[model samples]
Target: MNDFERQLQELFNEVKSMIMMGNKNDAIDLLQANYEAVNEQINAGNKGIEEVAILDIIALGYMYIGDLKFVQSLLDMMSGIVDSLKDDEPLLDAILLHMGSMYSTLENYEKSMLVYQRVINVLESRYGKTSILLVTSLLGMAKVLGSIGRAKKAVEIYHRVITILELNRGTESADLVLPLFSLGSLFIKEGKAVDAESVFSRILKIYTKVYGENDGRVGMAMCSLAHAKCANGNAEEAVELYKKALRVIKDSNYMSLDDSIMENMRIDLAELLHIVGRGQEGRELLEECLLITEKYKGKEHPSFVTHLLNLAASYSRSKNFVEAERLLRICLDIMTKTVGPDDQSISFPMLHLGVTLYHLNRDKEAEKLVLEALYIREIAFGKDSLPVGEALDCLVSIQTRLGEDDTKLLELLKRVLRIQEREFGSESEEVMLTLKKVVSYLDKLGRKEEKFPLQKRLSNLRMKYKQKVQY
Candidate 1:
């Protein structure tokens, strides 16, 4: 390696050490100093792969410290001159790969995909199409494609990655697990439960063969398999699998008790338990999740809001509005204190509390809270957005309970229908119920002309829905 590249490597290693030691401020200062040194070199007409290397590492350092603004600026600077750099420059490959990942993290998927393609091109030119080294960039491309809803293309790329891994490392090689797991996850998301089950079962077998039955990886695979089973309508078997996986995970100490993954697993199981008429068990699991988050992140931390909200939802589901109210209030207070009262996130607890209050027959209070939530959602998500539509729908229910003006309710329902049409399309089944509500309201108001068109549309939608169901 060149002197500058070697120095950059040492600098990053030191930065990593500082971060591991919880010296984030020191790491940032070190990165800032290096950034200046590299800037001076580029200003002095030494803009080359070595300079790109320094900038890339600095961007990664900022990303590590959760300073995405600096990462974006650095990426912008690199993008200006990256095309001028040689395709075969050794340092350039890693720099491009890091840039691609950073861009993806920043949600600039277009740029991320292009950068990943560039890295793939470099790797392919250097080491044929089947080279194991090409897997990293290919995986990045596949992830971007998946994020953008090109699942078919993403699936193709993932299969290609698996084929390459198998060609180089044999069919049963552990290296195949990454692509297999990714593809399996994609299948689950696409609602191909049978395909997902097969893929996850393959993963379970591979992990068991490689690391034995009690390994953490096997437990994780079992969890995925359980999810597929649940999706396939085998909830009893799925619950058994989930319980066994949890036991294995705990026994193996795969993650700490308060780990986010473990917390989510508990919450997922809690929700599923509630679905299967196990409300008391689900409530206990939700309580456990709350305690875990509270112990690790403190009760007032923003992270505690989700657990509180989940527990509140559980209580609400079981007709315990009083307990749900208390938990919802706690969630609102924590979120409002953490992110300010007007933040979009506060609307979640506010809407839930509105519904809870409505259920308690406190219609006036519910109307006030839902109005505030609707206002916040309109500002944050736009008047026509689905979130705003949800807030509006909640407000409609509260207003109806209050026996508000029929004309006003009718206007609100029409707005909701318009938003649904924009989001779910003009003839989507989702619009049918709202259309019926609108037509019924119009008939109540003696607007036959208005009700006639909507009534006709609703009939057609019902027909289409029935046909789809029958098919």
Candidate 2:
């Protein structure tokens, strides 16, 4: 080999050795050095394949960092590679898949989606339309899009994934459980509780036959079943499922399985307990979990703030207003520091603090804080959105208690009702929420007429949904 070729081979061998050693920091350093060397070589008109390999190494290292900026750089580097790559090139499909993974990490739903489209295109042209790679890419992309809030695209991709997973699994295979869980999760997010319940039940039957009732997979299935149960207003059933999941997680820890898996499971169990009226128990679990989280994530970390908020909610539910208010204030201050005052996370603590103060009979302070929250929501979601309606209800509730029944209170009520009807249909939970508020508004305003209509509507709804099963 020529002298230039010999040096380039040496550089590649050094990077390969670093990567094989599994020292991620050392590998990254070597990759950076290779990148600088490649840039110099490119500047001197060397269009050799080693430059592409160096670019690949650099982009892959950035992928390991996982923060959004690094993921962005990784995706940008992939786009550069894609533009330069030819169809049917060796490693081209693999590079595209890595690019898709980077976009997925960055939460770039649009780009992740487009790269999957390109993946399918390439797979169809080269490997035929029915290649397994197509299905794999679709499922992977669906997970990313779902995580990033693109539910429609996720549903579409999930449908294709279901078809492929089923085809590959045949009718009676246990592998169908995987996609069933994925689609069930999406169905839960979409409020299709019946559909999610069906999928979860099917998966539970198969998984139980294979792994029994107390396996970790079974624990997750139980947790998912709890979500479905909660959606159906079977809070009692949901609570039982949460307990079962918790027992399984505890068992797994006792058996020396992965603690990280059990940790998140325990958190979910605590969260479910809080959701189901076992607030004291939930608070205890959350407090213990918070100690671990605080050690790892610190007090101001968003996840720590999340656990604190849940504990605060439990305190509020148990009527421990002093502790609730204090915890909430701390969370609000932390959120304000990290996400700023205008961020939506600030509203979690803000609303809870307002609620606690209102319960403590500090009406004037509650009204002022709630009014600020309403103003922020109005700015964010427009005056007629569902969130605006929620703020209006909280505001109207305080205003009524404070006896501030001016024309503005009526205007806010009307706005809330409008949003409730526009967003949630007449018989839905949100409509019921607004109706309950309207009844309260009328009661405080001495409007027997308004109260009668809302009462009648609620009675009719109860009758219409009379067949709805509880637990």
lDDT (tens digit, per residue) of candidate 1 on 1-471: 777778888888899999999999999999999899989998899878878888888998888889998899999989876989879887888889999999999999999999999999999989999999999899999998999999999999999999999899988788988898899889988889999899899999989999999998889999999999999999888888998998899899999988889888888888889889998998998898878788888988765788888889999999999999999988887787789999998998999999999999999999999999999998999999999888888888888878899999999999999999999999997799889889989999999998887899899999999999999
For model 2, residues 1-471, the per-residue Cα lDDT tens digits are 256445655655665666667765776677677667776876786643445555655665655533357547645654765766676665566557767776776667678778777877888898776555677777778888788778887877777766766676665457677667888898888888988888887877777778877777777778778878878778788888877876885685543332555556667767777776677788888887678778876887767887788789878888899999998888888888888999765765787788789999999999888888878887887888787787778888788789885556876877888898898888886676667766765777788986897889977776666656442
Model 1 residue 99 distance off true place after TM-score fit, in angstroms: 3.9
Write down the TM-score of every candidate. Answer: 0.82, 0.59
Candidate No. with top lDDT: 1
Off by over 4 Å in 1: 2-4, 17-48, 65-89, 106-130, 148-150, 294-298, 302-305, 320-347, 360-392, 398-403, 418-425, 428-430
Q: Runs in model 2 with CA error above 4 Å?
A: 1-28, 41-50, 66-85, 107-111, 124-133, 143-159, 162-178, 254-312, 318-471
lDDT of each: 0.90, 0.74
**Model 1 poorest 10 in a row by lDDT:** 299-308
